[model samples]
Target: MAIYKLDTGWRADYSYYDSFGKRKKKSKRGFKTKRQASEWLTEVIKDINKIKNPYYDWNFVDYFDMNMELKINSGIKSETVNAWQAVRNYIVVKYFSNIKISELTREKYQHFLNEYSIGHTANTVKKRHQILNSVIQQAFHDGIISIDPTYNVRITGTKESKDASEKFLEADELMNLIEHFSQEERLSGNSSLSSFMIVLIAYSGMRAGEALALTKNDINLDHQTISITKTKGRDGINTTPKTKNSVRTIKMPSDFFEIYKLFISHKSEWNKNYELFDGRKIATNPNRTLERYEQKNNFNNIVSIHGLRHSHASYLLSKGINIAYISKRLGHANISITQSIYVHLLNEQAITEEQKTIEMLNGIK
Candidate 1:
């Protein structure tokens, strides 16, 4: 006899014959009510009585027939699966790990979401909601649950705009920042390092991650160009750029090539001790370096290392660089996105040009 417990506080008791024809009784635990126990009893009896049926096809049954732990082992990646494991550790162990898959409803998910609001930001809440929804969907697909519980639960959070996430330094502010950054770097015995990174992002318009991921091999000082092969995207995949257009090479500053060479030589010398920073492997967490620099310098407008990318694009506009060139240099997925965000600044520059034309025409008359 084998007895198993279902999540709905039900016990399934049964007896089975072993391979050697020995009778065995196994009892599964975790029953809270007689009705729940009776439900499992009925289901178990059917399985036990049908053992002689040749076409039983137990494998065809969904994961509900098995255990939650076994079903989680089925098809998702370890990282993704770990998210559900955390939820299980938090909710299931705290409340009811043995609750029936069919009984866990949307109301329960809503409650979890409501409780989550007090401590988590909307983005964090959304991520947790997504993790829960994924688990529910998997369970439904695997036949563990009759319905997906997370479908109706709403995440109460507004999505932040891509542009809103950034706060770029204006031209004068950027110059001041560079002056401060350079002075701090000089005092630290790494005079050119921080300035070179700033120049690379500002001039090339590369994402902070792609810039940080750079190694000495990725640069071509002789050719005066940089090959950007990878970009950080959602899911943390180290694949191609955001768009196909982003794969193009960037022309380096003619004078800056020598500076890059000098920086590489210094990094290479230090690489003898640290394997990761050996000029061959990717540069590690450049933003942390930027953060320390920002803290030391204490600029009024606090911004992330990523904001340097935006500042670069903004600087290009200020330099009278064509919009198309700026768009391509920034590796914008769409020209429309670049134009829409930067058109107002371009228009302001256009007003100055219009005034110059008027003055020239008036002088000629």
Candidate 2:
């Protein structure tokens, strides 16, 4: 090993014998100092040694960890990283943890896919498959693997994959939720805060992340508008809205705005930078609050907190409102996304119009 000082920076060089007894040389440039170059080169040499030594059997599980390290270092969205992490855990713990990467045969990978198909839906399996394929393809490109195991893998979808789009709140359901909660929330002082949040979320179509990241100053009770400039990520960290369209101003109804005013009555709760529900942790999950509402009222559908946003959108669509206005209200990046999710509802509207056209024709006849 040697480190050479140059006009621009230092260069590190290391040489070793390949598995075939051929001399192999490797070098890296742009290191700031001799010490830095030496250290980086030393690590590279050690890694190369590990890759070639007959006794050192590297597995895909460990390789994936190193691959993920690069992803984390590159400042990827925490939510996306978290999703890949679940896939990584499933791979490492469920299968292939002990199998050597070089020993991974196409037959063995096919067997693993068969096992994976037993439990997960087709869409679910496909997601995991996509992640694995990416890593395996990378390994192949890096010359670490002889062939890509998933090269010919085909994904077959299931009936579960074709399940109808998400469930949303109907007008009746929203009203029931609000009425039930308005009474129940008044009974429990903590309920009032979550109650307002439910109404705001249902009416405004704000994401759970945007709702959680709501600050006291973001709300204008007098103007009946709430500004959505930031959102909470899956990692529970507050960050700017994921998309530019996510930053929006949503107008609230008078009664709904009044609910917010009533909750912030106390001087301690009126903090500018503090969260709307500053002292209360009940708003953390809101599921418990919803559970309480369900238990007390015995509701038919189990709508999630996020479903309120869906409900709000569906409710607006039923009124024959402009899709563009709804898109902006929902803070969707484009109207196409709104149309895609609400296509079923749009079909229902078409059916209603068809019925009217048939009636008009019948009356003329």
Candidate 3:
């Protein structure tokens, strides 16, 4: 193997002699660094050893399939594996199916990004970039590529806002929603109550998946705290919570105990858990039910069911509660997440507190 620097970047050359003493040489150029050139040489040597390997001269799609198999067998969440598969399908089928990973270039990848981003949102592009970057990095790690094609590529796509959503119910509005839920539960006469799930999540700040993962024994009426050991994925598979913090117990309001008891009584005789809240195998579907309530009650601030957790945090923040406490209660890994989300509400509190201070100073004057 021989390496040389060129005005373009770096080049690598290799040679082998036949029995007849004839020289057979191969050379490749356009590597960004001498180290990259060396890495490519290593990949070439490995490919020469594995003449019959399917992935020996594979494209990005082939490499992606190989790496993803390892990723799946390595025991990541199935949902995460599914998401990665989705990214692979979108990229391979749409644009990069034929491009060999060894031949993939930064310029070509930039072009791919530009073309792939045409109709997608910035957030969508960002997510795809994350997955693609990982896939390409894996190829580089395996010495299949010298440079990561995804490197230095500018992101394109309409990015979503980082601000916390304001579409959540006020405290009084939540109570009104609970009342509506009660009505629905009574009229159905089936013990399966959609409102129970909502009320459980709203007051306890458990995620939709976390609440769905709860069993009858997970609730402690005497202690007024619900344990959140696991969470269900969107695919209805049981998995660990979002983070270690999310796996902690959440203290429930006293009002939640009776609701829990009532719902637990409704579980099918043969079933282990109350997974039939809306008369289905899954837990709850709040959209249609809440939509009807909002129309009939003339409620203006109708929040999504997930919005209940936001509303809970917003309400507590509005009441001058500690941010760290709120963060832990919501199972956020740290207080900063809570602070970022409720910054707008916190700013309002500052204004109110400042006004109160001025009023007190005026009395002193």
Give candidate 3 regions above 4 Å deviation: 1-56, 115-120, 159-165, 184-193, 266-270, 273-284, 291-302
On TM-score, the stronger of 1 and 3 is 3
Top candidate (lDDT): 2
**The 10-residue segment with the lowest total lDDT in model 1:** 55-64
Distance from true location, Cα of 343 in model 2, Å: 1.6
Q: On lDDT, who's better, 2 or 3?
A: 2
lDDT of 3 by residue, 1-365 (tens): 89999999999998755436677777899999999999998777666524423454787787888788888899888568878889878777668788877777899889888887787776778888888788888777766665777777887865444345446777788777766565435434542455676666677766777776777677777898878887776666778988888878877777667666666565445344544342132444555566667768877666666777887888788788888889998899888887877888888899999999999999994
Candidate 3 residue 296 Cα shift, in angstroms, is 6.1
Q: Give the Cα error of residue 289 in candidate 3, in Å.
A: 3.0
Higher-ranked by TM-score: 2 or 3: 3
lDDT scores in order: 0.61, 0.75, 0.73
Poorest 10 consecutive residues of model 2 by lDDT? 157-166
Q: Ranking under lDDT, best-scoring first?
A: 2, 3, 1
Q: TM-scores, in order shown?
A: 0.57, 0.74, 0.77
Best by TM-score: 3
